[model samples]
Target: MADKSNAESIITETQKRISNAFDVFDHESNKTVDVREIGTIIRSLGCFPSEAELHDIIAELEDEEPTGFVRYEKFLPTMTKILLERKFRPITEDLLLQAFEVLDQQKKGHLEPEELTKYLTQEGEPFTQEEIDEMLSAAVDPDKNVILYKDFVSMMTFDDTR
Candidate 1:
């Protein structure tokens, strides 16, 4: 129940922020924001993507409209992705810690290999056994057969090459 309420509040707040951004950037009142406006929006959100990166982002939106603009509805997903990836790193790390705490039932600050597998497959957002095995192989300490809280958080927050 509490989790549900928190999720709802997050969604509501995200919608409010997006709406506010749309209002600020949609200069022509055409319900779409131009590429120039997008650059301003991205900067306002505190992400300073390089000129090439910004050009690439704008290029991706070219197909969305003939005028090379993105409608507010269409822009929300991109905005959300950027905010999550850049502005919310600390929040992401904190969420990972909370999840680790749930699995560390005895407050031992680490999980036995088997406990890690069980938690991954049975609890929230179940992953396949193969996925769990791969994750363990990548980050688990072989001699101890346990994954420390720090290692687990590091693994979760790792930036994939892709």
Candidate 2:
């Protein structure tokens, strides 16, 4: 019974977040948004579904009416499932550390700023110069001029913004 209630709570909370994300695109104050904005809304809620996944979602939602509008009410259940069951979340701290390890050829458990910047700006999902600088600024050990990747991973994966 407790598990069931907890699941319900999760569903409710997920729905609330989806609604809030949808609200951002509901400029007319109506509870509907353009079908095209579905992907944007889902991304805003922190779930980066792949292109194929997004296409499937849009196709399913468009099955009812070709109105090109998504009703938050109709979307709530799907959004909740996506939030609760989706696999593509921010990488785990350990995983992030492993990625950093690849750049740390010495296996020293840290990275020099220049090396990290080069990898971050030239590798898969490359960051812009500005992004690399911002992240390095926060994670760099000023005294050592290196990034303690373990600590950086911790901050990236678990920092409390509030």
Candidate 3:
């Protein structure tokens, strides 16, 4: 089944990344780590779990003892599920480009910094000025005439490990 295949693939890839991350915390390679390090291990794998999720994980591990070692194997299944359920996955270039296209009134492939800033901060979940500044710094063309949106979107969505 297609649904089953998707789950299997996601589990397989997440397992590999999680294993790499767990190995870093399991310094002794014992496949076990302190419950305190659970949050660090999840973040190291690039999954941005919320404080509530992190607390839940720590609590789950603390069930047998207030603070104790957690078998990495016990976490592989749980981590894969968390990864699948995470909402803040990386954005795609196509979606970004489509948004830009709507803003490009004149059908220009680029946008002025001011125009881009207004839409970014005034619409949707308004981005902070600092976040806009950081994004624009690498996104703007050298001449500073306009933002090549295609290039900008690509830079934002890039993930080497993918």
Backbone Cα, N, C clashes tallied per candidate: 0, 0, 0
Clashing residue pairs for model 1: none
Among all windows of 10 consecutive residues in model 2, the one with the lowest summed lDDT is 153-162
lDDT of 2 by residue, 3-95 (tens): 999989878877778888888999889888999899888777776666678888877766465798888777787777777786446566777
Model 1 TM-score on a 0 to 1 scale: 0.47
lDDT of 1 by residue, 13-91 (tens): 7667777877897888887887678877766555557657778777766664458687776677777777655542223
- Which ranges of candidate 3 are over 4 A from the true structure? 1-13, 19-78, 84-89, 159-162
lDDT of 2 at 11: 81
Tell me the whole-model lDDT of each prediction, alpha carbons only: 0.72, 0.79, 0.78
Which candidate order results from sorting by TM-score in descending order? 2, 3, 1
Runs off by more than 4 Å, candidate 2: 1-10, 20-78, 158-162
Count backbone clashes in candidate 2: 0
Instruction: Kindly give the stretch of ten consecutive residues in candidate 3 with the minimal lDDT sum.
Output: 84-93
Error of 1 at 149 (Å): 40
State, as a TM-score between 0 and 1, how close model 3 is to the true structure. Answer: 0.55
RMSD of each: 13.6, 5.2, 6.5
- Higher-TM-score candidate of 1 and 2: 2
